[model samples]
Target: MLHSLDADLAVIDPEYQLRRAARVDNELIYLTRTGGGGARFARRIRRAREEVRTVCGVCGRPGIPRTRSRTVLCDLHWHPLTAVEKAFALSADIPEAWFTDEAEIKNDAYVARSAADQRKESANHLSERDMADLLGVTVQRVHEMFEQELLAGANHDGRVVYPRWQVMEGGRLLPHLPVVLRAADGIEARTLQAIMENVDEDLEGATPAQWLAHGGCVEPVLQTLDQWWWI
Candidate 1:
């Protein structure tokens, strides 16, 4: 019966068998004997069906879905898998055990560290009202300073907080604050704070904030900030 079918197919198309057997020669031969191909063709069909059914959970586009446990991501999001994992970990409702890869574990660790740093920064910061009271001005004035870019404030859990290092006990902003803010515009708040708070060897291990408090020259700090800001 198989030979009769092959003879008829050959009459219709001389290269029919060759074309059918182009890649899956063994499967084609198996199909000729069993009237169907076996595991190889079965697997291929299953994969094809999955490709057709799957869609990206994020963007709703249809494609091959790569899974990380319960999370289904398409190729676009999968390429930056670590960043996706980090974002998930940072979410308030995420489970602690969702991380599956070593890279994800590392990202979770980094996120934890960042959260801790933010908490510390928040603890050391002053609210707008508190800053206004300290500076003997209205809260509206403090907001004006932020809007004018004379002082930098960071959003913490939806509230804007000003770092303590930017203000002195006498309610005066650091003289170099404007220069640093202008030079480091568009930089992350945490990064800008780190730059201002880091101890400089040139200043005998005094942080830029402390050096400025002691009336150190703003030129050196501005020069150093310009060098590091681009990097």
Candidate 2:
């Protein structure tokens, strides 16, 4: 997605002032650059300025970063003296309260990483010309299909590409794709694609795509999405 990554999208985190707003990956990190200079502490806790990026502002780790402050963290230090993160935290001189037994951060990281992996798998996709030829439709009709949510297409760079799974044998559209597409309305393309590919208990252990591919009922999939993805 083309994000402005502006001040409006940032958050003033309690532990780390100025955080990059959660985007497609649902990951947040400190915004290191700032304009004003004041009391060291005031400058310390403000939300990240608009210059933040995907890498950690400190050690350049993923979401987690290494810094003198107890600001950025990874799952490793959820519990003090527990994992390598704890050791790193201790060395960084962060407060013990910064550590917790809750594994929420780890879980979120896993989820984001899994979604990213799914995106990579779907990256080798069909272009507009490919879709038009396969469906025996004009390229203009293909654009209409995307606008109507009749097809699943994600924006990579500045262009939109349709994932291969959206088409079945002989270039036919995947089963129930139109239904799922409508149900998934308003969600960004990459996330919608990930939800379709991710496994869910409500789908009887099948991913949405797989369940549909097997001729599963569209209602159950929609219901599952109500409680999960679509919600």
Alpha carbon deviation, residue 56, candidate 2 (Å)? 2.7
Candidate 1 residue pairs that clash: none
The superposed Cα distance between candidate 1 and the true structure at residue 108, in angstroms, equals 12
For each candidate in turn, the TM-score is 0.50, 0.51
Model 2: ten consecutive residues of lowest lDDT: 12-21
Residue range 1-91, candidate 2, lDDT tens digits: 1142333322332232231223333222222223332344334333222123334322234444333221333444322255786778778
Model 1 agreement with the true structure over 1-231: per-residue lDDT tens digits: 234444644454443322111111001111111223345433543443343346444443454424312233445435653666657655856444443466455544534544464466567789999999988999999999999998889876577888898998788888778887897787656556666777766667888788898899887777656544211
Question: What's model 1's TM-score?
Answer: 0.50
Q: Residue 9 deviation, candidate 1, in Å?
A: 63
Cα-based RMSD of the predictions, in order? 24.0, 13.5
Q: What is the C-alpha lDDT of each candidate?
A: 0.58, 0.57
Could you tell me the TM-score of candidate 2? 0.51
lDDT of 2: 0.57
